[model samples]
Target: MQKEELYKGMNPLEAAVSGAALEGAVASGLSDPFGSLDLLTIQVTPLAIGIRADGNNFVPIIPRSTTMPAQKDLIFTTAHDNQAEALIIVYEGEGKKVEENHLLGYFKITGIPLAPKGVPEIRVILDIDASSVLRVLAGVLMPGSHQPVNPVMGVRMPTVDDGHGWCAEALNRAYGSTLDLVTVHKKI
Candidate 1:
């Protein structure tokens, strides 16, 4: 019908975004997803996501409003001397402290070689795919070593869903900062 007129003076992408292509496809029993969604849509992060670090801080790996299908990593270290293990606690929100944000999930990184405080390198990675699924990965590496001592752990987020921050409060009261992590700041 009006298909010829819609394509008379427009490129495929322009026509698709102008709604003519989508309309024509529907009328002709065809399918086109981008026509309705448009070609310039960018999905941003809904909340700031990061891990708990020293002083119970929220060390952000992926800040809010970041595009989807993203992957980011950060370096952390032990808070105590001769620390053999550290807990990787993931949180999502804009709070500066871990307790102020919503607890997503947590995993304990064990088998850290006996070393002084801030001597080990603990790399934590966060990822969000096109489907909006979140995943976290962490591993331990000693100085001058490229390989991890233990197998990297990758887990989906929101392992704990107590929206009231009860989990964080309880965890802080019980384990405290004994298993906490400290951010490894990079020197400029």
Candidate 2:
């Protein structure tokens, strides 16, 4: 195709690039102008995904600009010593605090062996599939153990469809850092 046909009323550089693109598309047998038929295109996360940690902080596991079909795990510890149970409250947004973000879901990890604060390891994983579905998994683990003592809990995200703010608020009102977790730096 001529440059005039593919890029009408365009400057020389723009017309050349446009004509080349059209030729490349036709040469490659791409039926869609947007190239949606490509099977391996990338999609980025619309919002940051993380958990509610100590001091009411939003500790991000999968950052907002991360690509989809991503999985990330963060180590967290109990806020108080001998805290036998912890809450894994997931949120999605660009909030520095949990209250500013949307509540995705939550699960409680019980049956933790009693230990001093930050002694036990809690692995919280956030995964986002290419279809934009989010899954959260949390479990308690002993140091140097590859497996969890208790069964890991996996929860699909957006457990609250709307009024998510109130759900977060209600959780705070009901638990108020009693079951809070603190982020433990990755040792490896």
Candidate 3:
């Protein structure tokens, strides 16, 4: 959808607050306390509606984009319930084996009142960078090369070249699976 369609004239703050409340409710219902929210199931609507928190109303909107490691921006109204909160967790891969440590960002909305959970709105913008995949793999293969706070003895550190190879291998391994390299930008 178009950017204008997402906003529907609501200001950033209004979008952020409403989005956060809906997200907070979903987070509260998850089976795993620390699990990331599933992006595939989230339905994108054109306008905000009467999603209530405490006694207030809210509206949420997610932007449109075409890229890997999708970026999301959420906005909603201020909420009253302490239980009302929002969080964004980034994971590696599309399956159960995805790494949680790869989490890139997290956001929360607190101090919302119990009565006016629906009045105010909120806005959130998210951008996902997959470059860390390379870094993480490099660290795993060349343990000492990058240098962690406490390096264990007898551990071999791989060089930057090795990291590059690992990154390529990872992309290859994911070939025909969930990973594919695409030309994101073209020279003018």
Each prediction's whole-model lDDT (CA) = 0.84, 0.83, 0.29
After superposition, which runs of candidate 1 have C-alpha atoms over 4 Å from their true positions?
1-40
Question: Per-residue alpha-carbon lDDT of model 1 for 96-173, expressed as tens digits?
Answer: 877678888888888999999999989999999987899999999998889998999899886595588788887788
Question: Model 2, 1-188: lDDT tens per residue?
Answer: 65554645669998779767766666577888677545444678878889899779999899988988899999898889889988888887897987788888887889988988888888888888877898888888888788897998888876683754787788789988889899888753
Per-model TM values vs. the true structure: 0.78, 0.76, 0.22
lDDT of 3 by residue, 1-188 (tens): 65544546888898889878757766577554665554333433222211112221121211223343444433333323322332212222222222211222222333333333333233333333443121111001111234322221121112222323443334325432211111112121
lDDT of 3 at 89: 22
Candidate 2, overall lDDT? 0.83
Candidate 1 versus truth, CA RMSD in Å, comes to: 8.8
RMSD of each: 8.8, 8.1, 24.9
* Candidate 1 lDDT (Cα, 0 to 1): 0.84
Sort by TM-score, top down from the best: 1, 2, 3
Best by TM-score: 1
Winning candidate number (lDDT): 1
The pairs that clash in candidate 1 are none
Predicted structure 3, TM vs. truth: 0.22
